[model samples]
Target chain A: MSKSQLNLTRIVLQDLWHNKWVMLLALLVVLNAIAVVYTSHEGRKYTSQWDQLLQERDRLDIEWRNLLLEEQSRSEHSRITRIATKELNMNRPLPKNEIVVRVP
Target chain B: MSKQAKRKQKPQLIQWRLYVVVGFVCLMFTSLIGRAAYIQIIEPEKLRHESDMRTLRTTSREVQRGLITDRNGEMLAVSVPVKAVYADPKVVHDKNGFADMRRWQALADVLHEPKEDILKRVQSNPRKRFTYLKRQVTPAVADYIKQLKLPGVYLKPESRRYYPTGEISAQLVGITNIDDKGIEGIENTYDDWLTGTPSKQKVRKSRDGHVVERLDMVQEGESPNDLVLSIDQRIQQLAYRELKKATEANQATSGSIVVLDVHTGEVLAMANTPSYNPNSRENLQGFRMRNRALTDSYEPGSTIKPFVVAAALEAGTIKVDDIIKTNPGRMRIGGKIVRDGRNYGDLSLSGILVHSSNVGMTKIALSMPVQELLGAYQTMGLGNYSGINLEGESAGLIHDRRRWSEFERATLSFGYGLMATPLQLARMYSILGNKGVLYPVSILKLKQEPEGTQVLSPEVAQSVMEMLVGVTEKGGTALKAHIEGYPVAGKTGTARKAVAGGYGEDYVALFAGVAPVHNPKLAIAVVVNEPKGDRYYGGDIAAPVFAAVMSGALQMLNVEPISKREKVRLAANSRSVE
Candidate 1:
């Protein structure tokens, strides 16, 4: 019970009441910042993932075109046929060229 | 003391009532706060994305359609990007207070259209926020309008079809509508393959109606497949040019030429004169796109005789050296008289083919049962679809053996009482050229070369092939078709048009020929509907075109010409270019 002790207790009590709201506000700000950062980070992933998938789709499309071209080249005509026939010994058949009798 | 206590009790009851009312109000307020938190904070993000879809104006993007190209990579039809000019009528009209200086007048000058046209288009929808003033505007014109920066003016993308080769090969390419929907030809037949999927995008807009950002593209559409045709552009142009000139020169109604690959049965080129550009499809009639090769059927005349001879030989009913007794050029069988253009003596099947003998073929066909001949014709691709790339086709007319009469069968032997499309004849000859194996005519390369169906024995086909070669020799019907350096096999079919159910003097001249007869490279079936000239025979009219077309194709294909004995004879006959 000294005079200085009494003065110090009164100061501490007033300061406690006055600065209480600051601590509460700091807590709220921390919570809100964490929420915004986490949500935005999550939202950003969707567009990037879609971008990667689109690139993959493009690669697939080019592959498909190449395959089609390859297939077409494989079965494509080798040489002009009528031209080959005239040069080769290929000729149309005739009636007299056949020999037959009744099977019965 | 009692009075004071009663007064205290009354005041205390009033205080209690007041406290109760305050508590009720606080409860109600708490309920409202909870509901607001649930809606505004808990589900706010979910609703926020949804509102962007509706309130935020997003652009609906359309994809470019696929192009139709020939086998040789020539673009038959393609779509070019265009812009549609639109305006907010309310914004434009209200901005221009003066009557003469109205937005419509400016628009009319920019559009180069009449004032009334601009006025009517805008005024009809005066209050509309956006109205299309013109569609399918050129990019330069649209760019100019965009530069004007007029209020409420907008440009939307559209598609316009273009035909690069003009009318050449137009019929097969087909036409598209104003919305780029295919209407006819290959366009309609393969619409599902050509229609690309439209991709949708969702964008977020700021409160002030300015675009804030482009979100993910939602509901991605699939791209349609591309169609590669089996058409040779050079051959098509050659045939088209020659046929056009010949048709105009002869004053013929129209003409058609079809060149087919012998082994694969691929339609190398199908060209018809009097064709129209597919780009201007609205003004064109169906006639302009008719594929006469598959649509028009006629008696093939001598074009059919080779088939009959081949059938007889394949059936083992005749031998190559078998003799057929005949007068010089005529024969009578079953009350129907058959004759050739010139007299031919008694000859074997080979000699008959060399002479292009109609009477000899008739005798051979009649000697066999009618059913056997009909079966052979069917096997050779007659009386059925040729399976060509043409949209419409005729099965052609060959009566069933059950309906066949003796005279009819005999006439059919020489290409009468039987009908065939040019496509069908080309296909039949293609089988003959393919060593008696019939392949489905392919306008495009299949995943694999279709296994051919056996229609004739290989030996029988070889022997018949020799007879076919004779038709292009010194005394052959298609002597003109013989190239000095290329051996050719062909038949001339001069069919008198059927008028009033009877034969008319006017004729459809046709030639169904396999070129380089010794090693058939191309089979061509040509038809001139009605040539108003001194020469109406297939040998004179159509055979020459076949020769020109095949020769040009050979040269383009870099095929080395094979000079035969006939070329020496031709050079000797030339007598120093006399």
Candidate 2:
């Protein structure tokens, strides 16, 4: 080999030996960057799932409110009273007609 | 071999062409780097914003108003999901939304609107952005409209308030406007507590409109809270039915009733006659919408007499058994003639109330200082708000003048100079039954018993309560208010309404009382304004309503009949004697 080319190879070997720790640190940084990208992707996937669950909760809440309204409409006090008095032939007993037995 | 040697001699020309091509390639690379730098450093926001606009979105979660329930958890007011159908006129015109005439006909039929009217509303202004075709349509109707697939017609979510009990509890639960905003009664007082803010969030979405990531929250959301009132719907319905029947039978102008729990100071029922249905607003009048029990005040008439007697007893002016002369009942005071229905001879304190003799009350008032009488009235919660926290409450006016007159004092003792609402009278009776402890009235359901102020001694209050019992007995003025198995202690008042210069011909019939003299569970007041028939007296008109409501309410509460209780007491007493 030529003298200049041989001298260059020797200088490169010396520099690599001296800066081995710096090269290792650079490799770790590259790995950390890749890990960051992987974690963010997973985070987004979980967030989408959580959002869907939240939507389901809202939908269930709405259903509950609607059912409550329907139940109230069906069991109105006036309607019950009307049915009891008119359809069922019911009446409140007078105080004199009611006989109380002591339950000693 | 000769040709190859010649081509090799021209190698300089080949090197020149190669240098030119390399130089051109380097120049193109430099220009590409320059453009990239310009976009990244010099002006990147525009392009970044354009990209974000296509992917990022601002989404909001909608919230509805909370519910209002009774003490028993019965729904008084509820919010149901609905939709508002709106049209973008410009979009309709551009998209030829009117191409399908059959769809327009169906839309008009479902909305209950004339086709021509709706078409004109949309076609009137093509540039108009938004116009409501129909508001507060049911979700079923909204789904039908959605299925039509008409362009430019969109459905927006909304809420509507529904009252299941209709006019039975309308005055108390109140009504909301078309936009689900509270405008009256309990709804108006707690509007902010019932309405909650919607949540806003920034999010990133995929191409097909799926949320990929939640960026950040723009505004925090709060879930709406529910309100539970102190009213018992059963008693309210009973009272309203009874009051409505009485008002119509007597042909009275108006009426109001208030029922209060003696121990908790909670209002059990408040009903008014001429109440309108909150669901339908057609042909509604302003007068029928008022909650007269809290808003209107009239002279208390003889209802104030019991308070005066209590004050006299507290001041030590008269003993419970002392005899007061009512013979020759008509008396003149300060150039004014004060007379009773008839002359009642020497009467006890109980007899005075039974006969409802004004002469006896006038003499009792004269025996004490005017301040003592007024002080007694003030302590009983007269001339003050009931602390119910409702809108448009009337703290019935009491004269605060510095000067005093014997006639004014006499008039005040008979309940002519003072004015009070039906709710105030009920509160006074509640104090009487609660052993002279005055509790603040509450419309909202209370978690614990509130602290009370000691206004009167227990002994004086019990004595007054016992004296009031005779007012509902056989010979008493309010015999109709007597319950069969329970002892009722109440007073009747028929006050002449004051008009322009002097008293008018109209009379306000009132009965305020507490029942089951042993435990005193409830205090009720019934007021009927201006009966057109001859039966205009408080004992004739208001007493029967009080009796019906009181008996029904007592039975519902499971209060024991006084007869059985007295029998048990007698058995215990005999065993002790044995």
Candidate 3:
């Protein structure tokens, strides 16, 4: 075609070749920015999960304490004695009635 | 060429309009740049703070108070998560919370309050921000209230301390206030150790209540510490039951019983009569709440006779075979006559203890130096703190005076001039049972046995312990204290209550002893005050309780019975001698 157009195209190619490193760096920076967004999103998701887990731990702890209290109440000494005497017809044997067995 | 010629004719007008338009556009751009610079440089914090107010939140984790268990890991005191129901009055009015009257009635029923009272508290102050509807309701009740879904009604978490053993250990484990603060007993002593601090953190939250980013921690959480006491629940229950029965049967005013471990000096059981239930907040009398084992002091009566004998033996003034001549039933000491029920004539040391003769004890004390006797008492841990380190403990009074009187010395020998708590008496007995090694008293469970101080020579202590065994044998003072399968070495004391300048009609019945004499395991003391009936002797009331508790405790701890084997061996040795 025209010699002037050919000269302009060659000059544009030389400029692009000279600035190739800068272009690559710009692309990497864009990719890093996108990566930052993705990681932050993932971090938030995990944090919420951890928060839920902490709540679950607290709930279980409360339940465990309640169970301990319940067990203690059920095994109370006075209640056991009452049950043993009234319901089961049991009593502590007298000292004379207890037989002494020696172990060799 | 033709267009250029035409343009040249209107060039002046075009030039004027272009200059005006350019100036106006430049002015608009300059103003925008100036505003941006002012905002960024001068007033950024205002908008930043506003954004933070919406997004930043400080969240805290709930921390419960610690647990208190016995030596065997049985729970004595526990904290259960509860809820404090409150209301935002202003919000209630705005949300028309009272529109549904049935919901309010249901809440009142659950809270055990009248509907009008609950509504009035909310309606009384419309502008008020907050008010408590109820404090420390159970989680089940809190859940039920949540189901009602009354606007402005809210429930926040709290904790409540509960004692499983109730009145049996009320005076020892103590009770906490509604705000979860320890107010009395062991709970008060270790309040700081039993409390926990909640953790706090700052986080950025999104619009949908999701934690978007974690920020710096405001406070690191500390898990609460737990406490393990040395008290055995089995022994404590047994002691309380027996003490309650004895006091009720005798119609006594009050009583206290203390059982100590002879080896470790651990207080296995300390029970007081007229104890109130810690669970119920009704009728909590001051006298009833007193741990009389450590707090109340009284003249120890004949119980101190054994220690006096031990002191005389230690001081080399009295020998194991010394026969003190007690002729008449009474002897005049500085115009005051100390008398026994019967004259124990020309008796050995063991006979004096068996008869519990006041005249016999007086003669022994008068022979020894005053300081020598007092020093022996001090070494045996008399009139001093029991080393339990509990609150409201009295050191009991011992007159450290230069001036002396003969009658005072005589009275001190029989445990009248000085005073002591029941726990001190038990400790002295424990020393006797432990072969003169005085261990520091412990209320908390110990992982290892602590070093003990040699308070008395092992020979003197053993000889004294053997002599005390006669008091529980046939025709001795404390016949009731004798166990069927175990030999008990104990003394009986019936101290007449002192009034203004003289004595009162009341008597303090007491018995202190150690059981299974071959290998002493437990030392116990019982004190009953002011029986209404005629039978106020320590042998009758207090000795029976001591026997019942000690026998049961030995069985529970699996201490072997020494009766059959010892008797058979003694018979065989006697036969060979014959």
What is the DockQ of the complex in model 2? 0.44
Off by over 4 Å in 3: A2-24, A93-104, B1-50, B90-97, B125-130, B220-222, B563-578
Residue B76 in model 3: shift from native, Å? Answer: 1.1
Candidate 3: residue B516 Cα off by (Å): 1.8
TM-score winner among the candidates? Answer: 3
Model 1, position B549: C-alpha lDDT score = 86
Q: Candidate 3 residues A1-104, lDDT tens each?
A: 57545676778889888999988899999999999999999999999888888889989988988898899999987788889999999997655567668899
DockQ of each: 0.04, 0.44, 0.52
What is candidate 2's lDDT per residue for A1-104, written digit by digit as tens? 47545677778988987998998899999999999999988887787888889889877877887788788878876678799999999988766566667789
Interface RMSD of 2: 2.5
DockQ of 1: 0.04
lDDT for B27 (candidate 2): 91
lDDT of 3 by residue, B91-167 (tens): 99999988999999999999999999899999999999999999989999999999999999999989988888888
What is the per-residue lDDT of model 1 for residues B284-372, given as tens digits with 9 covering 90 to 100? 87777777777778888778888888888877788766888667688766677777767767777767776767778878887788888
Rank order (by DockQ, best first): 3, 2, 1
Q: What lDDT tens digits, residue by residue, belong to model 2 across residues B1-578? A: 69888888754567888899999999999999989999999999999999899989999888888889999999888887789999999999999999999999999999999999999989999999999999989988999999998899999988888887788788887877887778888888888898888889999987877788888899999878899999998999899999999999999999999999998889999999889998886777878888999999989999888889889988999887778998898889889888888998888887788788889999999999999999899988999999998998899978987788998999999899889999999999988899999999999899999888888889787777878887887788999999877778799999999999999999999999988777799999999999889888999999999999999988888787777767466334322321
Query: Please, what are the lDDT tens digits per residue for candidate 1 over residues A32-103?
Result: 999998887666555446545765775565455445444433433322334455668575322223233445
Task: Report how far residue B495 has shifted in candidate 3, in Å.
Answer: 1.3
